[model samples]
Target: MFVQTSPGQSGSAHVVVLGNEKGGSGKSTVAMHVAVALLQAGQRVATIDLDCRQQSFTRYINNRSAWARRTGLHLELPVHRCTEPGETMQILDNESSELGQFLNAVSAVERAFDFIVIDTPGSDTYLMRLAHAMADTLVTPINDSFLDFDVLGTVDPMTYSVTGESHYAKMLRDARRKRRQLDGASTDWIVVRNRISALESRNKQLVAEGLNELSLRLGFRSIDGFAEREVYREFYPRGLTALDDLDEALGTGPGAEHVTAQEEVTSLLRQLKLPIDERGRRRAANRAEWFNQVNKPLDVHDILGAPQTGFQAGDRPGPRS
Candidate 1:
């Protein structure tokens, strides 16, 4: 829900859509952590889980609620599940009435969130297009593997020539054209290189070179998303925030959750050019370590208690033409 701003709090209405046409791309994980980080930064954040089919963010929120209940950890994050008109359909014409209806639904909810983070489905869909149309900034996460980078373009085996035309590129070009046509939206598309290796590997360098070339030719800026680690896996059973693992226990504990969180947060800060002193880093690490050492996996129901009473997903009136 939206928060009425007071004199002291900062309000920057930024809508971020986490999207990629590839599956298993860590879109949900990045969305949840970014939402958590934004909350910690003292902004009123509202999450829109648009992936109704998988409900990944919804599940994470449920687990977060459970963990909060069992451990007395208070997370003031509000996540809303939004369903567009034609999400089930495989194809949608930009000029169709259904497309306009979906766009209006997103615009209506814009008033409720200080920062709206939209989590989109893995592949191309009507919902994904709607989100792109509404996005102020688009964050795309990519892994350090050649197979994963194939979505961007295919590299020739012998000569290493990169093909320009690909499914992902065409979709992006179409989205850009749509933004130009609408004339009110400008999308800042950020590419996050995910699953990065700590040590320098031959393959890593090749992928880096390929991405660099692609960025120069295509005009998309690059940033390090998250380094390759096991912490991502640990958050599965019970979702944990980036700072949630800042304590020492999380990083060194059985799950390696804390370490993973630390790497991800540090990488993001560096990418954004934000400063994080040593003391602040150490404190978070200790807390994570302690939590992992003393605690057990808590049920989501235990953390969050119960479903939010009287919350329903109903259609709002269409936007004015």
Candidate 2:
């Protein structure tokens, strides 16, 4: 059972789990950013990638390992683990086996790390549910579209009314109830709207209004997340996060795009209100300054040693190389 921290108390690592049931919602990307942000803050961070099939989060870390080794850069890498569920003749056996594996994974890092960031697959699974129930902070990243909004709540097309709670919302409520019953730990659910369009449109406004209304009923805080940027994707192959010391590692100063990306990460991390080194400080007075402390401009595209074939920048997506 997880214990909640109180005045003059210490306990397990805070688990921030990123999840959503729909694909292309950028769950893995958000998980990577959050993990890296915590790491850059001089905190001990561990990560778990439950998406065994894609393994995107694990792959990102692997890429990071390669980059750090090649450049001899002192980059902060999380103690990472990936779980592979085994097949069994009986369904109950499979569930039990997977649960044991998940618990073992948690036990391995719970005492060692300050924070554990988990990336769940874009579908409802046994492991996903287990991870969700364990989340101290449940971050649900969604695109700024009604299609994406439907995963949490159903909306009326004619009146733009949120008619009822979706399955995912109900699932979270049940998880919260179970958590309270188990050990009185509460999960903070934050709905982050990512990949927002630069151009303001009626659809965006409608989505915002619908989310606001849903927030009232669902009890989740909403925040603006990363805008659709090619910069986020370009660094994937090299395992470079906006929070990295790209200026020093790449032998060039940071560029405008790099600053923008790091600023977004800093702002997001500040919003998360994560626990760091301070004793009972809760949060830094000006955490945003961490990124701004070093601001320089070199062409991000030009510095990327990997093939820049997939993207050309300016918030556009190209065919995966």
Candidate 3:
């Protein structure tokens, strides 16, 4: 059996798992973002992609490494491992192989990294359930619609209220219970409403209400996530994140949408309430202070009189073709 060690109990890495039973819920995207955020905060991070078939999370990390190499930009990357499924025809053998690889990966990084971010598959599987049960923090991202909300709870048609917990929610309850029984550790579950609409609508209101009601029963905190933005899609190609130094990476000043997206990501990270130590807090504070000052228009005296050392303020290059 895998060891059930609570995070911060004996300096073990805290486990954060991104999980959802249904597809197209932005699970990999959130996983990548969270991993990068932790790394940027000056915390050691390792990532495990449990979706051996799809491997979307694995590909994203590869793309980031490639983009960083091509552009010669410093992109922080976590120690990553992608588990492979068994090649055997027997179901039991396949499960055993997958479990061995997963356990090995966890053991290798458990005490080395400050955090371990796991990206689970869209569908239920043995590995997914195992990851969920070990998670110190579980983040579930769902689209802002009834179709996606149904994965967590069923809502009444007439009243638009939460009727009962759905299959995935029930599974989570069981996983959390098992985790407690194993190690007396509590999992902080957060449900993120992703791709939220900019304008208010009746559907949005109803979904919000239903989620609020469900949160009361499930004991999971609900928070807003990324809005429907094209920039998020564009970032995939370059493996860039909202927290990155966009002007230097993109070779142009970031637009208002980019700034807003960055703010959203920062807000979400804060809401996660991860156990960021003093060093991480200082690094994050320093980075925030730099970003705050970097955008202000520079005066002539400030630019002309300054020694030309390395990258200077107000000297960012124009947009790349």
List model 2 lDDT by residue over 85-146, tens digit each.
Answer: 66878978877877787778788777656788999988888899889999988999999998
What TM-score would every model get versus the actual structure? 0.72, 0.82, 0.85
In candidate 2 the C-alpha lDDT for residue 14 amounts to 85
What TM-score should be assigned to candidate 3? 0.85
Q: Is candidate 2 or candidate 3 better by lDDT?
A: 3
Error of 2 at 228 (Å): 0.5
Check candidate 2 and list the clashing pairs: 254-296, 254-297
The candidate that wins on TM-score is 3
Query: Tens digit of lDDT per residue, candidate 1, span 77-195?
Result: 55455554344455444335455654555555455445678888887777687787666667788887878788777787765557565688678868877976886555767778888
Per-residue error for 174 in candidate 2, Å, reads 0.9
Ranking by TM-score: 3, 2, 1
Q: Provide the lowest-lDDT 10-residue window in model 1.
A: 1-10
Model 1 lDDT, full chain set: 0.62
